[model samples]
Target: MHTAEELLKLQPVVMKQLQMIFEKDRVGHAYIFEGGKGTGTEEMMLFFVQLLLCENPKNNVPCGTCRSCQRIKSGNHPNFHQVYPEGQFIKVDAIEKLLNEMSKTGLEAGRKIYVIHSAERLNVKSANTLLKFLEEPEGIVTAIFVTQNINAILPTIRSRCQHIKFREIQRDVMVKTLVDSGITQSMAATVSMMTSDLEEAFSLAKDDAFALSRKTVLKLVEATFKNVHEAMLVVHEDWLPLFKEREQVEMALDLLLFAFRDIVAVKANPEAMCTYPDLVPTWKDAALHTTFNKLSAQLQAILNARKQLQSNMNKTLMMEQLMLNLQEGKSFV
Candidate 1:
């Protein structure tokens, strides 16, 4: 669990606005948090709820050890409710039941807080039912909606709530945060380029398949730089077997693209943070021998393979062509 102050640093603008709203005693009945994944929207929502329900608070910060805070921390707070999509969408039945619960008196005397996660997954019927509750609710009701895409929400629903947008985490900040969490600098740097979300980056770094993909892609690059025939052999023997699935192939291409990009970066600056820091010496030698034009064309070949993958092109042929293109103007000496 993150402290309110920590969340504030993650989302300064949203935190400041929430603080002002709390201080003015103008807490609204509905709020919609809009942001990409790993943007701290969920954390901000929890902190906001704690501020409203905390038994003791000072300067708009909830006393995390208070009775109310403890209950909320344990997720047993009677005034708090959460709704998530059951399948493809949030059904009307779920909304109807929740609305009924909200209508009744609570076990505690305070505001009733309900959060709907992935609000965009609400079906038309359920969305309409929730909109009615949003229009007129029982005493001290607060509704919060969390979504990655706000445009998918109903216009009427959007009009009823205060919408807060969460910004993407900075790359350097994400790298440092991941490093502090005990992730390797090379892996943290690599995943940072793979995704903007810290949660997703963590997931990737911990995944065995992702690690294998990085290793295989680096091996392919090494073989390509050494000899075109060896690169083709690796593709048939290693690459094709490991990256058979469509998504797997895409991830492999991403790793390959970054590997070439590292070579280019090394040519310009020796100290550049690369996805595969272990290969810096090898890439440095290749960078010293290769022309930028050849490197750019090699990059373009990988990109073209990505585009061809979308068209359901034969993966084997696509990769073979990319290898040939990458081998052009190449010299290890």
Candidate 2:
């Protein structure tokens, strides 16, 4: 439950714009919050709504202790409505029903706020219906459309709303956030690159499967240079069982690539960033044994394996071949 100020820290410009709107008493009825998944658009929307509904708001900040704020945080406020896609798309019926609800007067003496999650999920018919509602702005009604793909939304809908874009969190900020949350610096750096969502990165850091997969990948990397047979055995017995899904496999490959890059980084400059900083001794040893050419070849092999995986290649076979190539220190080129 992030306060409006905390969520605004991620998007200072958007917060400034919102403050200007609120201070001028010119808050619009329709707004399009364009951002990637986990980019805090939903948080910003909720915060804005709280400001609008809070009885004791000051400088566009909601009093978290207020009844309206509490209800909004718990998602039980009478004037606050949310619409989600039924399956693949937001059906027309959902929009029609929402419009019907919005037609009524406010039950809480504040703005009637409706949030549409994944607005692009609305089908053509539903989108057209929403367009009609946006065209005729009702009394004290605010509609927030949140979507990752702004281009997928209808042009007419886009034209009717005030657009606010949320940018991806910066890597340094994300790393610090994860580190502050008790994740190791090495894992924080790796997970930050894997996801733009701070919460998802934190969740991945705490996931047992992700932790095991990372350990197994690092172990396989060490075994590849020390004993190829041991590396192959680990992939078959440990890595494969834990990472059967395509997404998991890809993530493991990404970890392997990062490991090789770390070796190169160590060789180039001892002070360079290392993804596996906790395994600096191991990386330093690998750097001492392997030349830049060998490390580059290994990286190329892992990248090639990634492309093959996307082509629906057999997972076990791909891993085995990748392990062999990495052990052989040979270039796919």
Best by TM-score: 1
- Over the stretch 1-333, how does candidate 1's per-residue lDDT look in tens digits? 778767776788999999899999999989999999899999999899999999888999998999899988899898888899998998888898888877776468879999999998888889889887798887888999999998998887888988888999878788888888898988888899999988899999988888888888888998997899999999999999999999999989999999999999999999998877878999999999898988988888888889999999999988888888788843221
Colliding pairs, model 2: none
TM-score for all predictions?
A: 0.87, 0.86
CA-RMSD of model 2: 2.8
What are the RMSDs of all candidates, in order?
3.4, 2.8
lDDT of 2 by residue, 48-92 (tens): 888888889887788888999889888898898999999999999
Candidate 1 displacement at residue 136 in angstroms:
4.0
